[model samples]
Target chain A: MTAPRSTTTNEPTDPYVDLPVPDQRKQQSWRAQGPIVAMVALGGAVGASARYGASMVWPVAAGSFPWTTLWVNAVGCAVIGVFMVLITEVWAAHRLVRPFFGTGVLGGFTTFSTYALDIQKLVAGGHSRAGLAYLAATLCAALAAVWLAATVTRRLVAWRQR
Target chain B: MNWLLVICGAVVGAPMRYLTDRAVQKRHDTVFPWGTFTVNVVGCLILGLLSGAVATGAASSHVQLLLGTGLCGALTTYSTFSYETLRLAEDGARFFAAANVVASVVAGLGAAFVGVSCAEALWA
Candidate 1:
């Protein structure tokens, strides 16, 4: 039971191996990707809006741990884990779904830039302990959340199939 | 007004990130996630600049909301970075996993600090 589960081997070990090349087959421009762009854009807007709303509800004060951001990132990581597991192992979701939810919404919802700024401010403001604690907690919790969600989701999917 | 701007900024930032990550990853064939790292660093720089402007009264609150809270917020992602790092460690590449975490945090902070400094120099 502790052995590593090799569920999906479809993804390249080096994910960057399949770079998009110029389409010699057609004279189509970058407009061909317009639909995906729109999907991502819409999803991003919604996600960011939700995050802003969350911040408004539980605003982060100066020199304090940003609970909102931490929670958002952790939740986003877990959701992404479950999402990827379902998409890869259980259901073949539409291509647009991945871009909209995985890339756009979840990506927008969980921010690295603000986290960095928060850390800088905390350290500069003499809240180094809180900053360090926040950093460690965010990293550990997020990784754990994703690992747990993905593992459980995968197992559930397998159980259902059996 | 702030809400609208936030949405607009995210509309542009999110897609820009998606495209940039795709383009960058396509060019490099490595297990290390240089694409996400690049975006996060760039976002921190922009956020730092925005913070500086806000602090110096050079920009309005609305501008900060739009650019910093909205654009930068959507552009950089902690989830993907964390997930990727975990995956690396799980795959037995413990060295790369540690490198990812350290490099991202250190470089992101450095970039934000630089951004603020640049903004102060220009504004003040």
Candidate 2:
């Protein structure tokens, strides 16, 4: 998978990004959790299904390295990064949505076991350098992705508010 | 094809993660995120054993899907781990952020090693 060359890092400037702030006209409280939870569940279902579909389509070829896993993890990380920012800033998506898409779907979609297995396979195949490189790249990229997404989303939200 | 098993495993694994995370939070009363750390490490170990077993022809694809795809898939969560670590860093808990990184990577790798060894021993 192709990596995003530049990372985003602006925090949301929108005062009311995702919160349904209370005012004389309306009040927001824990009561909103019910609907939020439902939204999360729905997002989780979609995320999980997409993950399964990806795995099925990109099955590991026999005796080959874990291209399928590498692709999935990288893509999942990037998507979560974007989705997190989108929901938080742009769409001002509900609070429950993160749990479904981020925690449930993306969390399930990205597999540490496969990551470990990929490295093991590389070492087993006498490609120790490649294995280590893969590991380093995956960890660094995944973390940066989230941060960048968060920063960008925050900025986008702020701009929208202005 | 075995969708039922995968779903069941995920349900069990997810709730287990939630309860264990809450328990860890309750006991430690710290921001260390011990629960996610524990789950990831343990998941890596179990997955390692499963992978080893499959490699050595001791396990079947169905078993792999059930345990690997369903259970381990649900058990270990990278997103939460990433988000928490970032939150820690953002909140100025730099030490916690560093600890989160070292602990997860090192322990996760170690657990996978143990699992592989355990599975190999079974065959040996």
TM-score of every candidate relative to the true structure:
0.90, 0.77
The best candidate by TM-score is 1
* Candidate 2 per-residue C-alpha lDDT over A73-124 given as tens digits, one digit per residue, 9 for 90 to 100: 7677667767766765467555655555666677667667667766776776
**Per-residue alpha-carbon lDDT of candidate 2 for residues B1-124, written as tens digits (9 for 90 to 100):** 6665566556555545544554454444355667788878888998989988987889998898778777787667766677667767876667878888787887888788788888988974
Q: Write the per-residue lDDT of candidate 1 for residues A21-99, one digit (tens) a residue.
A: 4465444536556667788789889889989999999998788889999999999889988887786667866767877
- Candidate 1: tens digits of C-alpha lDDT, residues B1-124: 8789999889999998888887776665456777888899999999999998898899999998899888999999887787778667877767777888899998999999898889899898
Candidate 1 wrongly placed segments (more than 4 Å): A1-22, A25-31
Error of 1 at B56 (Å): 1.0
RMSD of 1: 4.5
For each prediction in turn, the share of the native Cα contacts (below 8 Å between chains A and B) that it retains comes to 0.70, 0.25
Which DockQ value does candidate 1 get? Answer: 0.53
Docking class of 1: medium
Q: Number of backbone collisions per candidate, in order?
A: 0, 4
